[model samples]
Target: MDRPRCVWVRKADARVPGKLPIVYSKSYAVRFHGLERLHPFNAAKGKHIYKALCAEFSLAEGSFYEPEELTKHQLRRIHTRQYLRSLRWSLNVARIAEVSLMAFVPNNYLNHFYLRPMRFQAAGSILAGKLALDYGWAINLGGGFHHCCSNRGGGFCAYADISLLIVRLFDQEQCRVRRIMIVDLDAHQGNGHERDFSNWDTVYILDIYNALIYPRDNVAKLSIRSGAELPNHTEDATYLRQLGRCLMQSLAAFRPDVVIYNAGTDILKGDPLGNMDITAEGVIERDRLVFSTFRGLGIPVVMLLSGGYTKASARVITDSIVNLRQHGLLDLSPL
Candidate 1:
C-alpha cells in the first residue's frame, strides 16, 4: 500500500468562496432493515442535522463537503490490523454496536449496513481536520468515535477517528500542526484518543465526563492533562463552571496549533445513557463558549458530533451550530 502521507501531500485549498466547511455524506446514516431502532442512538442523526443546517443557513445541497468512505489502507494509519480484522466478524461488530441480534446476521450484511457508514464518518473527520486548518474552523456532522482505540472498539464507537485526524495532520508537512488539543465535552470520557496519545506530550486532552458512566477506564484518566469528573445528574451551572475553569487552565498550561472539540449532546436532560441534566440551551452555550474561546484567539477548530443518544440530539446540535454562527464564531470570511 502507498504511504498515507502521499494522499494528503497536495495541500489543495479545501474551500469554496461562500460555503461553510462542514463535512457530511448521505452514507453517514446507518440503516439496516429497521434494526437500528433497537438502539437508543439515532442512526439518522447526521442526516437530520444536515437537513436542518441547509434550511437554516439557506445552503444548497452541495454546500457541505461530502467525504468519501475510508479504505482499509487509510484506516491502517491508526488502526491495528488485528482490530480491523475483528470488524469482519458479525459477532464482534454486534458487540461494538451493542445490538445483540446483529451477532446472528452475516458479516457482509453488517459490513454494508453498519460498518460502511462508520468508515464514511471516519473519513469525514479526517477531511474536516484538513478543512479546519484552511477555513479556521470545520465541523463533521458525524464522527467522534472516542471509545475505539488503536486495538479495540466499544461503546458504539468502532473507529478511532479522533486519533486518525490528529495523525493525518501531523503527517502532512504543509499542515504544520505540531501541537493539538482535544476538548472532549462528551458525557463519557474519551478513552480512545486518550489511550492513543497517552505518552505524546504534543497532544493535550481536556475531558469533562460523568464519573459514573460506562467504560470507566481509570488508566485513561491519567492521560487527561486537565479533566473534570462530574457526578451523575450534574446540572448546567456546575458543568459550565468546571468547563470554564478547565479551558482557562488548559490554555495557560499549553498552547495548541489546533483544537478538536467533541461536542456531544448526550448531556441533555432525559438522555437515557448520559444520566446528566444539562438542558438544550446549556448545550448551545457549551458549544458557544468553546468555539468563542478558541476562535476568538484565532485557533483553528474541528468540531465533531460525538455520543448523543437521544432523538433530540440532532436538533440540539443543529441549534448549537446556528448559535455559533449567530455569535460570529463560525464566520468564514477574511479575518
Candidate 2:
C-alpha cells in the first residue's frame, strides 16, 4: 500500500522554560531544573530529522498535513468546566503562588507568553485524530501530556489533550470509531491516564516504563510482579523481548480501531531522567516492532513525541521517523 497520511503540528509558541531554571546548583533538583526547555528541542528536533529523512528516502511530502486550530469547547469535552475556567483565570491572576505555576500554566508567566504552545499542542492532537480518520495514519510533533487529569494538572502537562480529543471524537460520532488503544512508551507511567480512564470501557491503555525511579507508582498493584520494583538499568534485549510480547498480546486481545503511539526517547540509557539503558539502535527496533505490527493488522496509528531528556536524544527521535518514512509509514509533506 502507499504511505499513510502523516500529520505534524509544529507551532513555535509551545516551548516552555525548563523546570529548574538556575544555571548551577548544589542539589539534584538544581541539576534537573532545565528539563522543560528540552521539550521545544525534542519536539522541533524530530521534525528536522523527519524532513532530512524524507529528502534522503525520496518520500512524497504531499502525504503530510498540518492543522490550524483547536476550539475550547472541544477541550471542554475531556476537561472539567471549572478546570478550564481555573486555567484561564490563573493566566490573569496576579501574585499566584510559585508552587501553583506548573507546566500546564499559560506561557506568559514563564517568559515566552507570546508563543502559547499549549494551545497548539492541544490543537495538534485534535488535528492528528481527524487526519487519522481520513488517511489511516497521522502524527503530532508535540503531545503525550498524559499526566494532566480531568480537573488538575500534574507533571509537565497543561491539559489531558489526548483523552479530551478521544472523548470529543466519540461524542461527535466522527469516523465511527468504537474502540481506541493508547500505547504509552514514555519512560514514565501514565498515572493520570490510568486514573482518568479506569472506569471507561472503550479506551485501553498499554503502558511500558521503568518500574523504579521517577513516579514510583507507575505499575498498577495488580500488574506488578514480586521483583518488579525499580526497573532501572534493565538490559536492552530483555526490555525489547518483554515489550514485544506485551504488544502482541495487547493487540490480539483489544483489536483496537486506532492506536496512539507515544514515542518517548527518554528510555535511552544515558537519559538524565530515564534509568534504562536502551541504545539508539534498540529504540529504532522498538518503533519498528510497534508500527510494523499495527501496519500488518491494518490498524491506523497516530504518533506523538512523548519525552526525552538526554542532550543527544534528538538522534533517536530522528532515526525512528526515518524508519517510519522508509517503511511507507510517515507522510512527509511540508507543514
**Lowest lDDT 10-residue stretch of candidate 2:** 19-28
Cα-based lDDT at residue 205, candidate 1: 98
Off by over 4 Å in 2: 1-47, 50-64, 88-115, 173-175, 217-230, 330-335
Name the TM-score of candidate 2: 0.74
List, residue by residue over 156-229, the lDDT tens digit for candidate 2. Answer: 56668777767755654333566778888888776666667775667777877877755655433233211123
Best by TM-score: 1
Question: Would you list the clashing residue pairs of candidate 2?
Answer: 13-115, 14-117, 20-33, 61-332, 61-333, 104-158, 108-113, 212-230, 212-231, 269-277
In candidate 1, how many Å is residue 60 off? 1.2
Model 1 segments beyond 4 Å from truth?
1-11, 173-175, 332-335
**What is candidate 1's CA lDDT for residue 3?**
24
Q: Once model 1 is optimally superposed onto the true structure by TM-score, how far is the C-alpha of residue 308 displaced, in angstroms?
A: 1.0
Model 1, position 225: C-alpha lDDT score: 97
